[model samples]
Target: MNKSKVLLLKNCSTGLVSQVMTLIFQFLTRSLFIRYIGIELLGVYSTFTSVLSTLSLAELGFQTAIVFSLYKPLAQRDEQQINDIVNVFRFVYDCIGAFFILASLALLPFLKYILTGITVTNAIYLYFLIQAFSSACTYFLAYKRSLLYADQKDYISKIIDMIVNVIANILQIIAMVYFKDYLLYLVLKLMQVIVSNIWVHWVCARLYPFLKRGKINFTLLRSLFSNVKNIFAGKIAAYVYSSTDSLVISAFISTVQVGYLVNYTTISQQLKTLIAGLLNPITPMIGNVLATDSEGESKEGAFKLYAVMRVLIAMMIVVPFCVLINDFIAMWVGAEYILPASVVVLLVMDLYIHFVHSVNVDFINAAGLFREDRDNEIIAAVLNITLSILGAKTIGLAGVLLGTVVSQMWFWFGRSYVVFKLCLQADKEDYLKYWLKNIVDGVALTVSIVFCAYLNSRLPIANSYLKFVCSGILCEAVSVALFGVFHFGDPEVRKMLKYLVNHIGKR
Candidate 1:
């Protein structure tokens, strides 16, 4: 395999491993916190974290833009340019951190108004403060880590992140189990953030000693500032649409409801992370291909990746695991906090739509077409928030999901398709034709699998667990076989699979 492809696969593998560890840690943390602090406090905690995540827009899109901007220069082995870019990013992030601290402090007076469902006794202030500090530390750490990603050294970064997170979560869980104090838990969380940042920076410096040689250059700093200013504005708008829904839900609904919504969203987000784990390590490789290869080859690779990602993500998202979820949550968190059926269904649908968009969105972002991408994001965010509010009032939580689907279809998808076409210089007619064919194939596969699963469900199985396992296995087996016989036999699918198999064999 080529060096870039090798690096991409290695990074993807590491990222997948990290995701598995992180998911396990999240499961443990959620289980322990729900038990130790109960549902209400967990709701407050979720709200606090959501607010903090929204506040992370303060760093703008500089972190992402920096990585994309640096990739080509690094590929060219332009050390001076790399150093200059890194210096500028570091300076900008430091300023952003300072601004976040000031803004968070200024908003203290209206904290109660900002954070709905927070009680005086819930230590909401302390939670926000801890979260804010962690955010600041993360901003700095991210600036340094972007260089690793730009160089496709993401394996290193993911490994460090996985180790730190696993250790820190273990400590946090131990503290919670032993102490069961919110303040102490918050402190441990903050300390974990600090230590993780330090470790990331230390590893980064050790890996690239030249990073330590780079001095902050003011002229490059100004240029980066100019580039990032508009990017940041666009990112803020995107964050509003992406991250503000939970806060709005918390404001309009109850904190307990937010807790339940968070549970469903968390699962959806986990699926997203899984998809990202599968796709993201290819981003820098995409940049490398675009830099060093022919446009035709690059476009071919992009299309294949997009197609496979869509199919895999759809299968992961659309399959009705609701019965399994109901059982799992009941067994895990008890029936008291189990999510409503409507909410679960809504989340699943939302995740399916989101996954479709996620697979293609990276193509635009990694192509350095940020202006049009940002414009689309702004439009989508406005529509999403507006519709979400309108929908929430009419349909409750499901309305939010409906709003996301509408925004995605009407705003994000078309724009993303346009961006992808422009980036790859692909023909619109061909693109649509391919996607249409894939849709037909997908529907056929889905229907056949569902039919088999339904038939399997009628079997007189004494054990629900065994029945679930058997049904799932049967569905997957039938789906794969049908897809291979019908869809995978198509020339494009066969070609892509051959390419993948050859690539794997070479590696």
Candidate 2:
């Protein structure tokens, strides 16, 4: 096997293992948290996580641009150029870290306003401080890990992160159970972040001993910052679009409601993280392919296969999610903690939309079209926030998630258009067919969800866990069957199935 395929397998296998372990620990921690601590505190944890995530947007997508810049030099084995780029990366992160400190401090007074309905205690501020410090530490200390990412050595970091997460989750569980102190739990979380980053930094340094302080390449730095400026707009838009939902809920509704929502989101996020982890290996390879493939034939073929895979994966996930999410929540916690059916369906739909387009979004970044999609991202951001706030006040939680689904509709077609026109340079008919196919896939997904929901309603299982398991199995089977019925004749699907079967047979 070639180097790229080997790297992809290594990354995917390690990432899958990491995500599975992390998911288990996350549920265990969250379960202990709700049982020992309070759901309100869980809400606070979820709220502050979003707030800190939003604050971290000060990094302004520079890491992405810098990583993109590294592809060519690394591909050519130009160590000097790589070192210079790393120097630029180091300098930029230092500045970002300093700025993060100042920004976090400035936002301290406003925390009272953001954490509405919850008492703004000094311990809360201290917890935020520790979390902020941990985040800033990444910028100042762990920026070298990006080089590993650009080098397609992400499996190294994945393994380190998995180890750290398991250990941290174990420690946090002990703290929550024995100490029963939220502050101690937060401290353990901080330690986890620091330790993981430090490990990645060490691995990067050992692997790339040639990395050292060097003269900054001003011209390359300038070009990178130019990409950063365009990418920054999209970064802010993305941050506002996704991270602010919690903030809006906390401000308009209650932190306790945010806590209720967090349970569902935890499941969604864990799955999304797993999906991203499995798919992330493909990104650097895509970048490498784009850097070298001038004719776009290889890019188009890979994308078509990935597009089908994306739909298949989304169908498998979203359908089961719609059918079984509430049952799982009830089984995991209690039915009282569950959100309404409307909210659950909307949440699953939102996840479906995001999962379906995740590949295209990654492709857009690989194509370096941040500047092109700047306006579209900004518009979506504005639409999401506006609609979410309004929907929250008017129709409540379901409406808030509904805003997310509506806003992302623009992204679904908009991203595909840009990828086809600029990236692939495909003809109009191909783009139209892709759009039509996506529409059919969306319909199939929605119909499958309904069918699965009806099937789940008819299941005779009395036990909660058993019901969840049975519903999940039936939902998945039905979703896959529906997908095959819709796309069995698709040339891309046939080619992909043949490819997978041949590869598995070889194995």
Q: Tell me the TM-score of each prediction against the true structure.
A: 0.86, 0.92
Clash totals, every prediction: 0, 0
Residues 1-507, model 1: lDDT tens digits: 899879878888888888888887887888888898777777777776777777677776778678768978887988788878888888888888887777777756766664556664436666767777877777666678888888888788788778778877888888778888767777878777777778778887777667644678877656666667668856775676567677767766666677776666666678778877776756766777666766466566665656665765465445645334655576566777776667766665566556665645666656766666766767777888888878778887777766776777654466556654776666778677656865675576457546765767686887866766776666566656665665655665666677889999999
What lDDT score goes with residue 276 in model 2? 88
The reply for model 1, stretches above 4 Å from the true place, is 1-10, 72-83, 114-118, 140-142, 208-216, 281-305, 320-323, 419-435, 438-459, 462-464, 481-489, 497-507
Error of 1 at 112 (Å): 2.7
In TM-score terms, candidate 2 sits at 0.92
Q: Candidate 2, overall lDDT?
A: 0.86
lDDT value for candidate 1? 0.70
In the range 1-507, model 2's lDDT, one tens digit per residue, is 999889878878987998899788878888889999889888887888788888688788888888888899999999999999999889888998999888889889998888878999998889888888888888988888888888989889989998888888888989999989988998888788888988888888888899999877788878887778888888887887678889889888888899999889989988888888777767867888878889989888878888999999999888888888887887787789988888887888789888888778988878878778888888888888999999999998887888888888877777888888888889999888888888899899888988888988988988867878888889889989999999978877998889899999999
